[model samples]
Target: MTYFILQFLNGLQIGAIYALVALGYTMVYGIIKLINFAHGEIMMTAAYFIYFFMTLLDLPYFLAVILAIVFSVVLGVLIERIAYRRLRNASRLSALITAIAVSLFLQTLYAILFTPDPRAFPLTASSFPVLEIGEITLSSWTLITIVVAVIVMILLQLFVTRHKAGKAMLVVSEDLKGAYLMGIKVDRIVSMTFAIGSALAAIAAALYIVSYPQITPYMGALPGIKAFIAAVLGGIGLIPGAMLGGFLLGLVETMTRAYIPSSVAQLSEGIVFVILILVLLLKPAGLLGKSEREKV
Candidate 1:
């Protein structure tokens, strides 16, 4: 029972990180029909910014996080304006290829500038306190991860449902032409969506690095892919669905690794994809997503 509880907490921690990243994925997809494959690269860029701000500039952790998030928001908006805006009227395939290209470009640029070497993150698991209750032990990181994710989710829900700018985003998502005709700045709303998503990714980047305590130019790739899968599993465009999917994926992956023999524990990742396949086959619209027919 103690072991089970321990793994559950671990799952929540991992899920929290995935949820944060998936929120950005879902928000961008909800607003624009694009997948934004470079979104993960934005997270990577933010992590690098944090690394440099703390290591080179000797800034405080909280200040470094704020700066990194701001930089990432700018980067996301720039990517939308420079790479995606022109392709808005273009074919989906063209936009997809461009997203891939942008992701590759960022990866290459980071590799060149920072080198491909993995560096130790300034913070480590030991940096946080651990608590014990009877036979169960809890890490401060775990509590912080789950708490922060929940708070962010609540705040985002309020923003979407209560704020005027957020309402404009909904209008733009539902009908771009109608939004434009209604005097809503569609472009600005889209940029704002990217900005918000990038900020979430930046926060996730900080938490993830602190947990894993390692950094590399391509560090965001796998986690980013998994988060995208989580978004899809939860119904890609639904905010709550993204959170649910992340938690499910994290729990499943953690349990699989925990129970499976060490020799085949590597199969945990493959199992995650298998679960996704099963879910999609059973519910094509996703767990919480409703199916919609496209106009001919």
Candidate 2:
């Protein structure tokens, strides 16, 4: 039981990071109906920004984080304006392919510039003090991660329901033409969505480095994919769903590794995909998602 509780707590920490990233994925999708596959790459770029600010420029840690997040926000907006804007009226296939192209471009560009080797992240778990409770021991980073995620979730909910700009986002998400007709400045709202989402990704990248510490050009791929799965599992367009999905995915992965046979433990990743498949087959609309029909 003690062992189980430890794993559960560990899972919550992992889930918090996943939830942050998944929120970005879902937010972008909710507003623009685009998957923004480059989101993981955006996160990777932010991580690199932190590396450059800290290692190369010798800036303070919190300062580096703020600047990195700002840069990520700008990068996201630029991508939307340059890459995805024109494709708004195009077929979904076109937008999807462009998103994939953008993702590849970022990865390749990073690889060429930074090399394919992994570098040690400056701010790691060792940087934090550990906290022990009874027989269970955990890092301060774990508590911080969970607290941050919960705070973010609450703030996001409030923003969406109460803030004027957030209400504009909701309107645009529901009916773009209608919102525009009502003078909502749909383009601005879309950019805001990307900016907000990218900021969340930056935060996730910072938190993730503390746990994993290894930074590579391709570091964001696995986590990005998992977060996307989480978004889909929780209902891609629903904020609460993303949080739920992230926590569920994290628990499932941790528990599988802990309880499953050692020989087959390597299949834990595959089991995640299986969960995605099951979610799709069993509840295509997702746990918190409502089904909608469109006239074609």
Candidate 3:
């Protein structure tokens, strides 16, 4: 029972990080209908920014986080304006290829700059207090991560539901032409969406690095892929669904890792895709997504 509880807490901690990154995936898909494969690269970029800020500049943690967020937001907007905006009306395949190109570009740039060497993350490497519940123990950072994930999700929900800019986003998401007809600034809103998503990725990168403490150019790829899967599981465009999917994916992956045979433990990540396949077969619209009937 204690072991089970500990695993559950671990799942939640990992899931929170997934939730943060998944939200970025969902939001971008919601607004632009583009996958933005480079989204993960942006997270990787943010992690590098944090690493430099902390290691070279010796800035405070919070300040480093803020700077990373700023850089990510700017980079996201730039990517949208330069790479994706012109291709919005083009074939989906075209946009997808471009996204891949952008991702490779970032990866190559980082490889040249950082040389693919994994550097230790300074924060969360030192000893921190651990919390004990019954016989189960949890890291303080894990608890902080869970709380932070919940708070960020709640704030995001409120922003989308209650704020004026958010409503404009909703309108644009529902119908781009309708939003333009209704006098909403479609382009600006799209840019805002990218900025917001990128900022969230930045935050996710920060939280994730603390737990894993190892940074490299390719670090964000797996998490980014998993987060995209989570978003799809929960309904790609739905904010609440992204959160739910993230947590669920985290729990499932953790459980698989703990319970699977040692010889096959290396295949834990593969199980996630298997689960995705089952979910898609059972619920084509996703757990939270609605099925649409195309007009013939």
lDDT winner between candidates 1 and 3? 3
For residue 103, give model 2's deviation from the true position in Å. Answer: 0.3
lDDT tens readout by residue for model 2, 36-127: 89999989999999988999999987899899999999999999999999999999999999999999999999999999999998888877
Each model's TM-score? 0.97, 0.98, 0.98
Per-residue alpha-carbon lDDT of model 3 for 1-296, expressed as tens digits? 88888899889988998999999889889888999899999999999999999999999988999999999999999999999999999999999999999999999899999999999998882356888877777788888888988998899999999999998988888888889999999999999999999999999998899999999999988898999999999998888898999999999999999989999887886988997898889996789999889656
Find the number of clashing residue pairs for candidate 3.
0
Clashes of each: 0, 0, 0
Predicted candidate 1 versus true structure: per-residue lDDT over 133-178, tens digit per residue? 8999888888888898889888988998899998888788788889
Residue pairs in steric clash, candidate 2?
Answer: none
Q: Give Cα-based local distance difference scores for all models.
A: 0.89, 0.91, 0.91
